[model samples]
Target: MQFENTLEFAQRLDKQDTLNSYRDHFLFPKVNEKQVIYFTGNSLGLQPKNAKKYVDEVMQDWEELAVEGHFYADKPWWDYHERLANPLSKIIGAKPSEITVMNTLTVNLHLLMVSFYRPKGKRYKIICEEKAFPSDQYMLQSQVRFHGYDPNDAIVEIKKRDGEHNFRIEDILDTITEVGEECALILIGGVNYYTGQVFDMKTITKAGHDIGAFVGWDLAHAAGNIKLELHDWDVDFASWCSYKYMNSGPGNASGCFIHERFHNQTEIPRFEGWWGTSRETRFLMKPQFEPMPNADAWQLSNAPILALAPYLASLELFDEVGMDALIKKRNLIVAYLEYILKEIDAQVESTFEIITPSNPKERGTQLSVFLHGEGKKLFEFLMKNGVITDWREPNVIRLAPAPFYCSFEDMFRFGQILKQGILEKNSELSS
Candidate 1:
């Protein structure tokens, strides 16, 4: 599809968009008294207008029903988390019984490690990608240290080739094989946060299982942004934050996928809590902990109704539109964005290096661009001009044109803003 850098071209794409009307469902922030062109959905998603209604329902339940709201409310507070399972299952390609809403992402990872990361003798090392998200890095380091091993020895990082931004699948498989006997766990981010590169999870999971290692994924960025088949991929376990592309509120509840094969395995150690017990026996005050037959066995406490409310609201949108539709729009919009970037680069003769994979299969909503010749100042200019985006250290700016709320017009407008920012920076220097 040939893309032209013109307003009419962008508007035509918008008109043809089936999900274009859904953009009105979100609440955008105003900058300079106008709605900002949001590009940071990879970090925090725009709030759904219905999110307020969901939260209000929960609040009213608590207000009027009191403690009895646990069983009497419209959604029933006690089993409210269960409502998310079916829709979420569709999004991540897992059975409803295999998925659960639980603690935050890193916390869930730590809790899941209690069951999956069993290290003994030589098979004690954990294999992960180099430069993982800092939270993951800290979690791995702390977990290994807790198990009485130096992190430098216990964590095996698969490094990218020098001068390359993305890790090769061959290098990853080779690392897993080389660390074969020693690798106890293989956990990697399904979509790399920094480079916006989507790892080959199914192949990587197979490689990890070929050896004697439990494999898992941190799907923080991949959860709603990419197509995932956690169940069919035979992933041992996985966790993700709901705030980013999932469009839940900030720091909301997380989603977990534990393959059904592990459901009734009582021998697998987990940090049991009040909610982990069977629901029928929960009110009985039984001393014995009888775990649920599903993924709810991992729940340590009661669900956070406020957080889950927004998440359920967001999931309704996902269910209505479906992932297939989202991905279709995502591919075209991202391609259009890339074209606009290249066209702007040619027009301005500015060096803007997009480090993300050009292959649509290897990326999601994000584009991490290295802003050469224009750095912090250009980022500031965009911010002032109502182009809300993300900035990493040094010069790379991350722009995630989320398909739900972001339009093709946003892409064209961003290009114009980017070009203006660069030219303005040059003018200041020349003056």
Candidate 2:
């Protein structure tokens, strides 16, 4: 389908969008007394109008029931997080028994490592992509150091080929084969935060396992933005934050998936607490640990009801629209966004380098573009003009048109704003 950079064309696309009306469910911030065109949902999602209602319900329960709210409240705070497992499993493609909502993303990664990242003599190296998210970098470094190994030796980073922006599948597979028996674990971000590249998880997981290594993913950007099959992929474990595409509030609870084979393993090493024990034996307060028969076995404490509230609310939207619908819109909108960027690039003196893969299967809702001949001033111009987006170092801006709330009109408006900023800069330089 052809796309045009006109308001009428954008409006017609919007009119035909089935998910278009759902935009009203979110509350967008205003700039210049108008709702801004939001492109930072990959950073922090806009607040759902219903998020307050979810939080308020918990607040009201706490006010009236006091400590008893854990058992007597409408949803029952003790088991409130259990509500999220089913819907979240659908989004991440796992059984309800394989999913659990718990601590933040990095925290869950640390806990999961206790079971997956074991190193021994002659088999201790861990494989990961180069320039992973800073938090994951820190986590890997610390974990390796804690296990009494030098990070420089224990961490094997798969570097991108010269003049390439994304990792080639063959390079990754060859790296795994080269690492061979010494590779203890392979953990990569499912969707690269910098380039928006979606790695081939199924093939990569198989490659890791064939080399006698455990495989997992940090789904911070992939969880709600793209389709996944963690169980089918035979991923040993995975974790994701809810605040981004999931539309939960800031620093909200994270969701995790642990393959069913790992469940109820008495010999498996993990950091355990009372909350991870079977519900029947939890309140018994026995000295010996009795683990749950599912992913909840990793829980360190009782659920944070308040954080889970907003997340549960967001999953309602996911359950209603489904990931299939979101992905369908995502493909078309991202394609249109790419078209608009190329069109605008041709008109302006500046060059736009889209580092993200052009293949729809290899990207999510984000387009990380390098605006050559443009500087932070262009980003500032955009921000002041109400285009909410993310800026990386060296003149790259990440635009994520979240399908649930972002519209084609937003894309059209952003192109206009971008062209205006470029032209204005050119005029000022000539003067």
On lDDT, the candidate that comes out on top is 2
Could you tell me every candidate's TM-score relative to the true structure? 0.99, 0.99
Against the true structure, candidate 1 reaches a TM-score of 0.99
Model 1 residue 274 CA deviation in Å: 1.6
Query: Per-residue lDDT of 1-431 in model 2, one digit per residue for the tens?
Result: 98898999999999999999999999999999999999999999999989999999999999999999999999999999999999999999999999999989999999999999999988999999999999999999999999999999999999999999999999999999999999999999999999999999999999999999999999999999999999999999999999999999999999999999999899999999999998998998999999999999999899999999989999999999999999999999999999999999999998999999999999999999998889999999999999999899977999999999999999999999999999999999999
lDDT of 2 at 185: 97
Q: Give stretches of model 2 more than 4 Å off.
A: none
**lDDT, each prediction:** 0.95, 0.95
Candidate 1: tens digits of C-alpha lDDT, residues 321-350 = 999999999999999999999999998857
Which residue pairs of candidate 1 clash? none
Q: After superposition, how far is residue 70 of candidate 2 from its true place, in Å?
A: 0.7
